[model samples]
Target: MLQDLEAKALAGDAEAQALVHLLRLLRRKAYQEARAYAEGFPGELRERLLAGLSLLEEAPDRLEDPLFAAEREVLLGVRAVGEGRREEAEARFQRALALDPYHHRALTNLGNLYLERGEVEAALDLYQRALKLAPDDPLVHENLAALYRKKGDLDRMVAHLKRATRLKMRPPVSLDPLTGKPKRSFRIPLWVWVSLLALLAYLFLKKP
Candidate 1:
């Protein structure tokens, strides 16, 4: 069945190609999906799928494809940041940004690294850049709010917190109330709950 689908996909059938690409993504075989779609898809769909694949941090091998090399470089930068190699990570991120200025992951990671290193201004700049590129990224709003809080800019922090809260709570038009269903409610990460509790505690303490 799968082989038949692949054959059909390779025969310029867009729907089959899209299905194959989706299956590959679900299997976590993103690089292969990108390669297949790049090889089989016509033009715009191919470009979009390849771009989506490049965003996956796991697809380093896909860097060999010229279209994805810049994304791969950004992923390497993020890896360096994770390993505590700040300078190398920053350099790599800069290179990636030079190649694609609106790379959201690279911008966010660079902002976070700068924040960690106490370069608050630089971090804010990077976060702003990221926001321009990916306005709906909750993490970016969260981080920016954190920065403003640390800087004692209460008004800006509160504004950003409101934006983050709205962003976090926007729901799909329909949701599944049952478990083991095709549609389900999004799970809030544990850290968000923890932060909420902390905020409540601070408010309670201040009420006295």
Candidate 2:
């Protein structure tokens, strides 16, 4: 859908062109430019672009899209952390979370902050909330494991470590929570699998 928007924008659609610009700004690190563009969205332009965004809301998690303010603040917080400005980073993440309680990255980063400060209980709560929202994230699993270890919860630590290992050993998969089954991927045609297995068996039998 975004690809289609790009095509339309390139072909002289004014609304698509504006929306493409907004998306570009969203992805960029230029806070001033992005904010200015967002603030200046005139009535018609704003509605049209919002409609375009709604058109792209095809994912199961679309309802919780992060606000632009929350996204920018989280981005700044992430950069600050990389620069070792721990205090500023914590403030930024906190502000982002204040604006959007369900901002997953902000929660995870702030949890890291607490964990670094030896606030085991706070960090564990944030990590658990984050993991609840993003259960399949291996890095989050590792972080949660470390948080558990900080509090001497060996069982939980081992569980998260095992989950992280399992995720690492497999191709990306999403489990259906209701049934605890992995969602199937696009399958190879059966003939291709059979031929590959036959070739592998022949080579194995030929080996010493």
Candidate 3:
């Protein structure tokens, strides 16, 4: 149903577009819930959620839209990032930034790429640029905090973490409430659980 709706949406069906939007929202919610519940090995869930997010980030483009080309480039860059093609992703992001210097998402992702590559100063510069454009973006703050943490700069880490928490984007997950050991299960919205269970049931019932 999602694939069919996506096809119709791409073909310019308004109703299909709405359905696609709804499905995308549900998918995002489910991904968030799963991420929240993810335990020791978080890399897998993080990658999965990021991949889904990158795809959804590209879904807003209309064929003739003026921003379509830029969006496509950004999406391609994001895919390259996912594939461990850092240089390719960096080039694509640079091109996208050239097209729109104030593109906050491109800036933020570029900063994160730099951070991953151990280019702390470059990452800081890019992140600062992004923050100048979107000071309230909690993801940027969180990424910056991670960089600070890596550098052993606890003060800056705490500052950025505080900003991220203020933005309400970071889920309050930590050690166990009782023993201070890492916890596995985290709270998620009831609707997300319902949707996930429903989807699982549907898949099970449809199995051959």
Candidate 4:
């Protein structure tokens, strides 16, 4: 489960950070906040996330298909961003959304670009729209939470974080700077899983 969550996180699951945030809150005995966060997940968005995970994971397989023109454009946009071609990247992302209004990842990357430029309102708009299009997307949720946090809105931040935590609540790992490998595996014993589940129920369901 740990490995699975790490794979999803490293693959850019936005909500991966939410799980990390939840764990941090839990460790700090911020039970009220954690519960508040988790309660938000029992909604339409949770259903979407549960349903769409497989589709997102398999999406890259279609990159080579002719029908995935918009997806290809998103990749180009991402590459452009990495190359520091800001204008080009923005244009590529915009072109992708023009081709497919529901292009989830493209919206996310574009939102991120806006956020980096300190365009909070534009970034928020894009991120919210992105979440609506891909509610189960971890990265979108995480980004939204970050935006909220930046705005000093802890409640909203925790709400989105909870949504992300529901996606893959596993211990995060640190990479070895030299080898680019995980420094340690979060190997939990079966008994711990059972106990953890019980604790989760208490933490999330027992009203604060």
Candidate 5:
């Protein structure tokens, strides 16, 4: 879907270009930047994007707009999560999914809610569905990694953790949260270093 958006944007679709840029910022969790960029557009588009960004603000009130019903539900769901209203949050996320099954954040957040309750299988299913929609979502990968670790699947955990780390631009050699083992970086063999040193020393002596 993102690829399609980018292709359309490149083909001189101004609306597609604007939406693509907005999505890029949103994917990075840059709400402020996305809002500012969205503001540059006019009319309905600006109103809709601004309304969606409002969900990320310090204290957001529910905004009613049929055009953004799904996003509005997601915002309410997130607020419910923060307020310790887990049931309410779940319902909101579910409603958002009913409105738009492809809503990636809704799927991820609902999965998180399930994971918190030790509903591992359900959470795994939701996370996988969310990943199908947004493959580059670092948060989904991180959560999925945690889920895998909880299931005692260390290899899969490490794989997803590494992918999440790379997506978030973190140091590659991070410590394993489960085993306290840091991933080792490759080093030159001792024999190679010794041979290089010996060759350099011989060259210097010959030059003298």
Candidate 6:
């Protein structure tokens, strides 16, 4: 796990380096330190890493794929969520699904919104769809664990929790730096993925 991040960080992948360093600080409940470290970054990155409320950078028009469009909406929805704009966030997530139904992040995020609104069945459906697309995404498993616990299904909840934990313990060679989450080996357009990595450097950087 460390090797992948280390290699990328050494190779000047600023996003990976930021994640590796900030995650360590945040996990230790060092919010000030995390914030300070984030401050050290230049320009928009520093702001984004501090949860600045800007729209996610637009993807290049040449991409011309619905998946990149969907990803943009998903990242924007994530930012809206951080800004506490639940209704807007819901709209954005729904729009993403309309563009590309197979978008894992959009599905998972929409499921999370539904779960928060007490729409258990709706959330379950979306989560299941997301799991189909990215079966090894630890966030999906963790979310399923939460959903099962809410339904009073202790067995299923415990199973998902354990699965998520095990996945996290393994090396995150294919980690999604945007969210600091483990991901399965699935192909995504390189430009789209890089754009996401650039815009969402703080998607998971909540105050500890």
In order of appearance, the predictions have TM-scores of 0.56, 0.52, 0.51, 0.50, 0.64, 0.53
Query: What are the clash counts of all predictions, listed in order?
Result: 0, 0, 0, 6, 0, 0
Q: Which stretches of candidate 6 lie over 4 Å from their true place?
A: 1-67, 174-208
Q: Candidate 3 — which residues are off by over 4 angstroms?
A: 1-64, 169-208
Q: Compared to the true structure, candidate 4 yields what TM-score?
A: 0.50
lDDT string, candidate 3, 97-187, tens digits: 7765656678878888888879999999998998887787787889889989999999999999999888886465544322223588868
Q: After superposition, how far is residue 124 of candidate 1 from its true place, in Å?
A: 1.5
- What do the candidate models score in CA lDDT, each in turn? 0.69, 0.69, 0.65, 0.67, 0.77, 0.71
Candidate 5's C-alpha runs over 4 A off are 1-29, 43-59, 170-208
RMSD of 5: 9.9
lDDT of 1 by residue, 25-76 (tens): 3222235534554545557765765565755555664556544545667777
Residue-by-residue lDDT tens digits, candidate 2, 60-107: 123234435555567778879999999999998898777756566778
Error of 6 at 207 (Å): 65
lDDT, candidate 4, 11-102, per-residue tens? 88756645444433332323445444544455764454333332323553345433244555776787789989989989988987776676
Cα deviation of 160, candidate 3, in Å: 0.9
Best of the two (3, 4) by lDDT? 4
Q: Among these predicted structures, which one has the highest lDDT?
A: 5
Clashing residue pairs in candidate 5 (N, C-alpha, C atoms within 3 angstroms):
none
Looking at model 4, the pairs that clash are 13-139, 14-138, 14-139, 15-138, 15-139, 49-136
| Candidate 1 backbone clash number | 0
Model 2 regions lying over 4 Å from their true place: 1-67, 173-208
Question: Which of the two, 2 or 4, has more TM-score?
Answer: 2
lDDT computed for candidate 2: 0.69
Residue by residue across 94-123, what tens digits does model 5's lDDT show? 997887677788998999999999999999
